[model samples]
Target: MRIYISADMEGVTGLVDRDDVQPGGRDYERGRRMMALDVNAAVRGAVAAGASDVLVNDAHGPMRNLLPEDLHPAARLIRGRPKQMGMLEGLVAAHDAMICVGYHARAGALGVLSHSFMGHEIEDMWLDGRPVGETGLAQATAAAIGVPVVALTGDDVACAEATDWDPSITAVAVKYATDRFAAELRPEDDARQAIEDAVSAALAAPLAVPEPAAGPAVLEVRWQSASVPATLAGLPGVTATDSRTVRAEGELPALYRQFGVWMRVATALTNQPPYC
Candidate 1:
């Protein structure tokens, strides 16, 4: 069996503040190592579960966070990007199941460091009129490519959100969110063990592909600033619903591509300082 794992940092064990996820922040190294550990745990689990192939996607910012020397020898890692699927990159027909490691809850969720893609500018995201977070979007992307999201590891809120998307999905919460930036963390070793066990069990089960949404998917992004949405209004099939909301209607794959474009545009606009 082949398993795909998407790893993000904010929901990794013991990470609570923005500094932990930022590249230059004092805790960034710790966060990166913890994320690598978490991914390795999942890799071990998949191996133990009889998976013949495992692919780990560094899905966080810049898409190049995992330490190559420290990663599990059995698993291959996908790093860097501009890929068609952002977090869900490298997903293909051969992957039997998918797991999201260290995933947080949606933007504005109670989970620690909660935010969807482009946390700095996007207020929230909705699919087919229902609000969904990164995990949901990731699940949809997996489904579009015919892979089931069999398991996920994150904080309490993220696990709950996963279950809401697919109740049968196995979930391991490494921490319990006290709020957006604080959590009562489970010990690092304990969290790793739990992830390993949960992943093993999830992979052992029958593939339960999430039911795809009926009809064309409509994705709406609510921006932190009205100007951001306005700027995206001219894109084909993208409509500025209001001052702060942009809606894109199309097949799931197409919509996802558009979302990636918006994220890159907005991130570029906000992450730079004026030249003069």
Candidate 2:
């Protein structure tokens, strides 16, 4: 079996603030190590469960957070940005199963460092009338390529969201969220062990590819700033559904392509000088 893993920072054990994941944050180094450790654990778990090939995607900001020197030797890492599929870029039809490692909760959810795509730039997002966070959105992208998300690891809220999306998928919550920036964390060793064990168990069962949404998917993006929606509304096939909400309609792949572009734009706008 070939396993694909998408690893993010915010959901890693002992991480809770932006400073943890962002480059400027005081704890950024620690956070990156934790993220890499989680990925390594997943890689080990996948290998233990008979996965012959493991591909890990660095899905956090800068898209290069994982330290290659410290990563597991059995897994190849896909790092850096401008990826065609963003978070799910490394996933493809050739992979037998996927594992979403160290993911956080959706925007407004009670989880450590919880936020959707571009953090504060995006307030909410919906696909085909169902509200989804990073896990759900990434899963859809993987599903498009006939990959089933077999396991996920994160905080309590993220695990709950995963279970709600597909109960059969294995979920491991390394922390229990007390609020957005705080949680009762599991010890690093324990979290890693649990992640490895859970993944091994999940891969031992028969996995099924998830079905894609019906044709002409509609994506509703609610931005944190009215300017974002207004800017997107100017694009063809995109309209402002509300002051801070923009709507885009197209085929799944096309919509996902555009959505990646939008995320980049929003992220750029997020750090501009107030005068700009």
Count the clashes in each prediction: 0, 0
Q: How high is the CA lDDT of each candidate model?
A: 0.86, 0.85
Candidate 2 local distance difference test against the native: 0.85
lDDT (Cα, tens digit) per residue for candidate 1, span 1-276? 999999998889889888788787799888899999999999999999999999999999888789889899999999998877888888886899999999988887778888887764778789888898899888887787779989899999999999998787798999999988789999999999999999998898787666677778889989887777877887778899899999888887667877889887776667631110
The CA root-mean-square deviation of candidate 1, after full C-alpha superposition on the true structure, stands at 2.7
Q: What is the Cα-based TM-score of model 1?
A: 0.95
Cα-lDDT of candidate 1: 0.86
Clashing pairs in 1: none
TM-score per candidate: 0.95, 0.95
194-276 per-residue lDDT for model 2 (tens digits):
99999999898898877877677888989878777777777898889889998888876667889988877776666632101
